[model samples]
Target chain A: MIAALRARNPIKPGKLRLGIGDDCAILRPNAGDELAITTDFSLENVHFRRDWHSPEAIGHRCLARGLSDLAAVGAKPMAAFLSLALPKELTARHRGKPAWVERFFDGLLALAAKMNVPLAGGDTAESPAHKGKAGLVAADIVLVGGVKRGRALLRSGAKPGDLLYVTGPGLGGAGAELLALERNPSRFTALKVAAPGHPHLYPEPRIAAGLRLRKRGLATAAIDLSDGLSTDLHHLCGESGLAAEIDATVVPIHPMAQLAEAAGWARSALQLALHGGEDYELLFTARPQTKIPRELDGVAIHAIGRMSKMRNGKPAVTLLEEGKAVSELRARGWEHFRGSSSD
Target chain B: MIAALRARNPIKPGKLRLGIGDDCAILRPNAGDELAITTDFSLENVHFRRDWHSPEAIGHRCLARGLSDLAAVGAKPMAAFLSLALPKELTARHRGKPAWVERFFDGLLALAAKMNVPLAGGDTAESPAHKGKAGLVAADIVLVGGVKRGRALLRSGAKPGDLLYVTGPGLGGAGAELLALERNPSRFTALKVAAPGHPHLYPEPRIAAGLRLRKRGLATAAIDLSDGLSTDLHHLCGESGLAAEIDATVVPIHPMAQLAEAAGWARSALQLALHGGEDYELLFTARPQTKIPRELDGVAIHAIGRMSKMRNGKPAVTLLEEGKAVSELRARGWEHFRGSSSD
Candidate 1:
């Protein structure tokens, strides 16, 4: 297993003094830089099901989870470690070889290579029991990134007047994909227009855009859209000690949102735009005076809301339509213990 | 879950610029040191069973696995992260909360506090299906440590003439504890004398001893006794292109080994010492002529073997009984995917 991983992940020279094959990978951070580390746990039946996701897609999604967190902080990836807990059945040798394990690494390594993130070191173990019973398979990713000292983008730096923007193709629509995929997989496939619109399964983490935002002093506070716009904006608001006033009509709805609406569901495109999660887009608050561009290196930026001072007896997130308060955004998103209701 | 972890793990003021609750943890390493990162995945059924082990033991063992790797390289831990994949059934709100999860962190945080390894950051997620069905629970720990720029030990630096040493209260004996624990939990409980001998369940990573060994330039190559004496020695031999010659008579047998033998197990004490794993002891090679002390701090150092120039087509490990070659040691040990035969 170790040999297979090392072969799939070729040692990247420079910066990394030592790589995989060691007891602990040795890394040297650049002078005047601070290291940023984030971890994400993806599980079978929870994050993805075997029937729904290919081995490669599972691998791609696992690493993307951690990379998205790095993007939220505007940090560039240095290296990553993976810890896999496989059901023993999956690890069973077929024709005297581990074919499935190799394929899984192929998918994971492909994404790592595309993002310039080196797969440094990790551990792999199987489930204890295998009395011919299938169990859960999990992948945990730990990403180490670096940023200039005192310059990391935080979720608590937004002021009351800060403008809130959602980066990448859009937000909220990504969550709608999960809803469609779970309710009816066949419909989800038929509704898909192209690759860029499938935000749930194939999330493109805004790594480069995040670094650019930090380097150019564009975003004051930032967070990844993992738990939908409503909940995520609430998190930022709580951290910044402010509330958010969102213009519901201006929010960009995903192409799949139309499919969800056509199915005669109670939710409209606007509702999906506010409550959907797993977008992996960058949601940030910027100074109102700053001249923000509509696009950055191909990523579309859309103004969705503005940070507002908390008014007595008001929710953290307020929905505004035609400059009048319509309703409050409730804390609803993809929660771990919460059942399929979140999806 | 976040509140429980924070309450248990108090922040230590120092190089940690930013800790948990952020998108990514920010750490600053010392100017002249390099960072060492290791990850260990502890899975339910594989590493521990919900019935056999307490929630606390599961958490402690998770972090211990990663810390042992850091100890093998003689690095001082700076901080650690945990990624947990929990079964949703365990997280159900039953009498106003998750008591088991809190206890799990209680045990994990206690160890981190004792080791001075701060709980930096991590991720938590639950299994999707929790309609009264049990799912897998797993924890993956990522430990970041530090060692002087050029002093971190490698497993490939052993010379032919170097003397092999096993540090900490002998190794092989600890693997016997697991066998006893699995075959008959009651018998294992009755056999336990005190804490010092129960190496398998409550392992004290030789972190300080490893640091001392590296700083004094006493050990050339080192590895943690995680995969038993036979396989780990084979790993070191493969890396250094040298073979090992161990005297079977000098191997320390755990007190529990006798219990396993009394229970009519086929394996003897010496056999358990050679093939049993999860010892978490440090095995290294030092200059034969060096006047090494019998003890460093409180850890016991035992010279069990010697590194020898490899003869083509010979086994990596040779076992000697009473100064005569009894047989060659085959690379047989606990393997993840190799079925129950390995366990």
Candidate 2:
């Protein structure tokens, strides 16, 4: 399997000194630059169920999670290291051919090629699942990215009057997740409007926009909208020691939001927009005087909120209906230990 | 637990722009330098059985595996990212306080501090083991190190006349295993001579030794002794397109080797030295006139073999006793899929 992965993803020239067949992958980050490193784990039954999610979806989702983290730091990915733990069923050579593993790499590498990042080095191991029990297939990806020295955007730089913005569509992950709960994954591949679109199956990281925001000196603070709007906004605020007031009506809901509500998985588009996780969009803050554009690379950038002073030292997110604070966005996001029941 | 670890090991200045409390840990490798990255998976029941190993021991072993990889490439440690998949039993807050989890971090952080490597960014998730099943506590560690440009050692560089050497005592891991199988956990701590010594409990990486070899332009090729002498030698030979002849009598046998044989675990010192795994020592080949030192930092450097031309296009390693080939070393080392049953 390791040989097959290396064969599928050949190293690009001048970037990697040594590739897969070595004790370690040797890489040269651009001179005088900093490397942004992030690691994420996509675990079975917690992140996805194999019977419901296709191998392609699992692979794509794992890389997307790590890339989104790099995007939050406003760095350009150079290479990735994946450590995968395979379940026993996948290794049963006597039973049948394991095509799922190949397909999983296909989906993962396809995304990597599109993003121009090489899958350099990794480790593969067997999960400790006894007979008659379902084992967890976990993929832990470490993404190495490069950014200008001392210029990587941080989560703790937002000021009181800074404007907040997010890139890409909203609630796509939540919409697909609703259809997944219905337990008919084939619908995701067969039906177009009734299910989630390509946005959910293959969410692209806002790398270009993030780099632009960093290089142009536009974003004061940045974070990926991985843990839903309310929870992530609270995180940014908590780090910056401030609070935010989001205009509820201005939030853009996913096009499949109506379908999710009609299927009784979501109460409303507004609710989904507020608390839906895995959006993989960039939520950033910019100076109030910065002349921000409406979109970058044809993706809409909505102005949803503004940073404010701390509100009574409680939770840091405030949802404003019209000009008054209607409620406090006290909702939580994905918790790996507690299981992402809300997502 | 994450906060505790961050407090325990703070990032050193100038090397890092940001640490722990961010989307990603930001680091700056010196200009004109290359980065060596390696990842390893330490899984429950595959790498170590929980009933037989303490949390601290497991933690130390996992990080040691990754550091050994870096040491093989002669790269100085920079930072590490760890993704831990904890079982439900450990995460259950009501289960009499999760001391094992804390102890695990304690063990891991202690090694990181001693090695001067910062614990940067990581993700923690719940393992998918249900009640009554043994949960797998797997840790995937990615270590990033810096090396001079175009100077990282390669396994394929060994020539016919190069001499091979290994650092540290022999069969430490195998000796420890023999004691562990005897089911007396306290013996390893109390009766040091009766069991494997500090070499087993805390296998140190020969980072400084590797750096010295690289700086002095001594080593031609290098590999870590993770998979025993026989298996790892095969790897070096296969990469270099050469064969090897190892003198079994000259191999440095650990003092506790007798304890392993007396306990009916190993047949002889020669056998254990040939096939013992988890030594975490550097096995490198140097030019014949390199004037290599016999010892480094109180560790013996044993020259047990030399590279040779391919023998019959097969049998990459020939075990010789008293200057005559006695047998071909063909026994396999630990395999994750096969559950490391032989070890």
Q: Model 1: which residue pairs collide?
A: A128-B45, A128-B46
Q: Score the docking of each candidate (DockQ).
A: 0.50, 0.56
Candidate 1 lDDT tens digits, B293-318: 78887888899879999998877899
My TM-score estimates for the predictions, one after another, are 0.92, 0.93
Candidate 1 stretches greater than 4 Å from native: A88-98, A128-132, A183-195, A263-266, A335-343, B89-98, B128-132, B183-196, B262-266, B335-343
Task: Name the lDDT of candidate 2.
Answer: 0.78
Highest TM-score against the true fold, candidate: 2
What C-alpha RMSD separates each model from the true structure? 3.5, 3.3
| DockQ of predicted model 1 | 0.50
lDDT of 2 by residue, B1-343 (tens): 6676678767778677688878889999989889999999888867876766667777887888899899898999998888898875675455565577776776787788788898887888767655457457878999999999999988889999888898876654554454554467665533211123565566777888888878888899999887777788888888899998888888887766656777776677566667767777888999888888988767668898888889675578888888899888884654422453210
Model 2 lDDT, residue B327, Cα: 84
Give lDDT tens digits, candidate 1, residues A98-210. Answer: 45566567667777888898989888766554344565677889999989888899888899899999987655566666666677665443321124566776688899999
What TM-score does chain A reach in every model?
0.91, 0.91
lDDT per residue (tens digit) for residues A117-208 in model 2:
99999888776665556557878888989999989999999999999998876654554454555457665542211122555566778888
